[model samples]
Target: MDPVTSGILVVIVLLVLMAIGTPIAFALGAVSLGALVLDQGMGELTFFGETFFGHVSSFGFVAIPMFILMGAAVASSPTGRDLYRSLDIWMGRLPGGLAISNIAACSIFAALSGSSPATSAAIGKLGIPEMRKRGYPDGVAAGCIAAGGTLGILIPPSVTMIVYGISTETSIGRLFIAGALPGLMLAGLFMVWTLLACKLAGGYNSPNPVAQAAAQIKENVEGNVKALIRVLPFLLVVLGILFALYGGVATPSEAAGVGAFLCLALAIVVYRMWQTKPIANIMRDALRESVMIMLIIATAEIFAFALSSLFITQTVAGAIADMEVNRWVLMGVINIFLLVAGFFLPPVAVIVMAAPILLPIIVAADFDPYWFAVILTINLEIGLITPPVGLNLFIIKGIAPDIALRDILVGSLPYALCMILGIVLLCFFPEIALWLPDLIMGTGS
Candidate 1:
């Protein structure tokens, strides 16, 4: 069978399985095993365990769970609420201030949690109700939280970046640093769109004067100060970990370990979560998410390996290289492919299966790998709110069941457009993603 034909068939089968609600890990594993068996006979099954194990048996992969733990620790606490309250107090006076505050809170919490759904859940729980209370439309309220949550993957300490780094043999620290500026840029875009949207909708403030007075009272100086005091330590811990990683003081895994411990400690001290249940809940949430991600990584590795063994990866890369198109044209095509892939698969799975195949082609085309990383991340971030498998959409629906999914979807579309705009801007000015990494690491090849 031709590699292209086989690849298409494999993808079709995988999609069918997923369409029928098969879990991603199982779908990947089953399809890969079938591909290998057909290509190399039943004997190929013997090496399956080793292939899967070897893919995940890396010191670098340890960072995923640790970063997840860090996020879990913070998500399991009241940190999201504190962070939201603090931002709302400061920014909520502006037109659509509440919506903007949710985006800002999501960015900060993204740094803390690094999981979109977790960020959405933590912030949305508080943000959605507050925004709705302030006369923000349900679609806008849910949309902002859902869109903001997507920031988790683009920000530093991102688990998806770690996965991309490990898969492509790129420096995790450089990848993390590479993400910082673009993450902020994307957040700023979300805020800008939100402000404009709110203004167009006659502002986000409630009409009731009594409610207005209560909002002002709630935003009092003392409460804002206390909120900041509670949220500051977690922010410091994230910054310190990034410093340690980029400064070469520690490896990604070491930085993550220390970061996780400190985040858990802060949750304990600030929230007084001395009891076993909250602590156990943190560990439990971390374990569940970590296991799911690890399984996807392991299975996706087998899938990638099978493609390589069957010459599918090389065939695809070679065909693209042979196209002899302009680098920018190639990038545009790649971005379209990535956008579609992301709409279906989670970022980790997409990176694991596609990055190895795409990285060489990207480098060959003279694109900066670090810059491409940010673009790829933002592409997947948009996927978190898109349809059929938009995880953040469901999370928003889960939190605010009264809000129509269409409203959430409608609300999130503009933010997705903002991400697309961010990508286009990055294309024109690659430095938005590259400058920080270059400054810290002294340039890249």
Candidate 2:
């Protein structure tokens, strides 16, 4: 059979499996294996095993679990609660203060967690209730948390970036730095939109809920100084990761190791969480998440191997290169496709599946790889809040059972729009995502 025809069959089979609710890793692997059988006979099955193992064997892949462990440590301990409390104390008095603080807390937590659902769960648990109690609309509060949680992958130490960097052979450290500016920019945009929403609605303070929330705020204010003191170590962990990665002091993997250790130490020593069960639970949860992610990556590698062997990736890139359409127009079309795909696929699945085909075309278009990474990251950020399969949306729903899923989805729209706006800005300016990485590491590094 012709290679293109064979490639088409593989994609069709993959989709059929996915549509029936097969896990992404299994779908990818099964399709790749079937394709191998058609093209090279059953003897090629051994290659699949080797490919999967070799892909996961990378030293760089170590960062994923380490970052995950760090997040888990924070989650399983009191540190996460303290960080949220600190932000609530400091920012809760502003217009849409609770929601704004939710964004702030998400950004800080994203630095540690590197996973969207985790960020959403950590903040949504505390933020949604407090905002609702304070007379903030349920949709608005839930939406803010859902949208803010996307920062987990957009910010530095992002697991998605690590997967992108490793899969594409881009510099992981530079990718981490590239994300910092855009991540913070999007967070700011979310905050600005949130504040505007509050002001236009005559402030988030509902008459009855305001009185109720006022009392709660007053009670927390007396201990604000103490809360700030408790959150210092978490602040340092964020700073330390940035310094280690961008300052040329350590590679991303090494930085992840350090961050994970710091989180563990803080939980056990400072928080005095000496209980064995918490530690055990943290390890178990982190291991489960890490294994799931690694499996997706390994399967994606097998799929990419199959595509490369079929020359599908090169053929597709060549076809795009020959197209008469403007590169920017082509990029916009690709972004639209990714945005839609995000509704059905997780970020890792999207990155693994699409990056191989689209990345070559992007590089050939003279688009800076770093800038495109940010653009793609922002697209994934929007996907986190989109409906049907948005992980963040589901996370909020899970945490706030009383809130309607429609309300959560509705609330996330503005922040999603902000992310879309951020993408456009990056496309036109390109400098926003590059400046920090360039300043710290220079363009070549």
Candidate 3:
């Protein structure tokens, strides 16, 4: 068989495996190995080691653990609860008051933790009960937490943005800066949905005002502010990491290593939670996650290499070019494809699989890949909150099982629609994404 035909069959087989419940990393590795053997003979398998070494050995990926540890520190420490209470007080007066607070808290927590599940788990723990007590529907509460927590992936210092940058060879700093606007934009969209849903459902039910019980809420808010003040050292540690990288004082990988140590020291000073118990546990956990991701990346890279070597890029690109659709129309089409596929797959895999295929068309149509990337990330963020395999939804469900899956999924509809709208707005006007990156990185350097 021709390389193109074999490559196409390889991908189809991989998707079949994935649809049949095979793990993503395994599915990718299996097809990748198959492609190498069938198209180029087992002799070429040597390239897998080189590919693995080149991509996985990078220091930037260290941010995955650093950010994860920071999340764990905040999760296990006293500070995490306060962040939620603070956001709750500030945004809780609105319709779906606690739901609004969920969005606000996720963004704030994203700033602190920079990981979606961390924000989801932290806020979901606090936010879910608060909303439940306030007479909010269980599904709405769970849905808000699930959707809001995805903020971690898009905000600055976001592990997803960092990973995307490393994998795509785009500037990590630029991707970080680029993500700022769209990340916040998506957050804003969620806020709007929370408000509107709560507003529309205003007539559904009424509860005795919990205004009196708010004494504890107010106290919690104040405590959160105080915790923020104490956590300033940790904040400084993170800020210094980002500032060093963005200001060109350090490369991203170096900053990641430095950032990890700085965060550990800050946790020690402020919380004094550092002992052999947590330290050993944190390292072990970090190492485990790191090893898993590194292995997946290694295998995925080999898979990507074989597929591309078979002209998958040009073939897919040519197919799209032959469609001869207007560039904007094509953007819409790719985005819709992503949103639909997102319902079934993890967001990262969706991006990895599609980016190589899509970038060529994006370039041929004169659309900026960076802009497309931000737009693509937003669409994937929706997937994280959407039904079926939506990752964040399950995170909340695990935390609060009394909440029916249908409610969480149904409550997510408005927010998901808002996300779609956000994507459309961004597609029509690229500046929403490009503006901040342009200011920070200065014209594609």
Highest-lDDT candidate: 1
Q: Relative to the unseen true structure, what is the C-alpha lDDT of residue 274 in candidate 2, on a scale of 0 to 100?
A: 86
The prediction achieving the highest TM-score against the true structure is 1
Model 3 lDDT per residue over 1-445, tens place: 7656775688679779988988778888888777777777989788776875786777767666666666566555555676665555555556676777678778877877777777888888887887887678776788778888887878877776766777677787877777788888888888777777777767222122354466765666667678667756666776787788778998877777777777666666777775788767656766665566556666667677777877776676677778877878887788888888677766566665677677778888898878877887888888888766788888888888888888888877777778778877887788988887788778857
Steric clash pairs (candidate 1)? none
Cα lDDT tens digits, model 1, 1-445, are 9899988999899999999999999999999999999899999988999999998999898999999999999999999988887787678678888888889999999999988999999999999998887688898899999999999998888999999999999998999989999999999999999889998888875333334577667556568689889999999999999999888899999999999999999999999999999999999999999999999999999999999998889998888888878999999989999999998999999999999889989999899998999999999988899988999999999999999999999999999999999999999999998888888798853
Candidate 1 global TM-score: 0.97
lDDT (Cα atoms) of all candidates against the true structure: 0.91, 0.83, 0.74
Flag the better candidate by TM-score, 1 or 2: 1
lDDT pick, better of 2 and 3: 2
Query: What's the CA RMSD for each of the models?
Result: 1.8, 2.5, 2.9
The Cα error of candidate 2 at residue 352, in Å, is 2.9
Residue ranges of candidate 3 with Cα displaced over 4 Å: 2-8, 203-210, 213-221
Candidate 2 lDDT by residue in tens digits, 88-171: 767766788878988998998888788888888988888888888878888789988998899999898799999899878898
Question: What TM-score does each of the candidates earn?
Answer: 0.97, 0.93, 0.89
Better of 2 and 3 by TM-score: 2
Candidate ranking (lDDT, best to worst) = 1, 2, 3
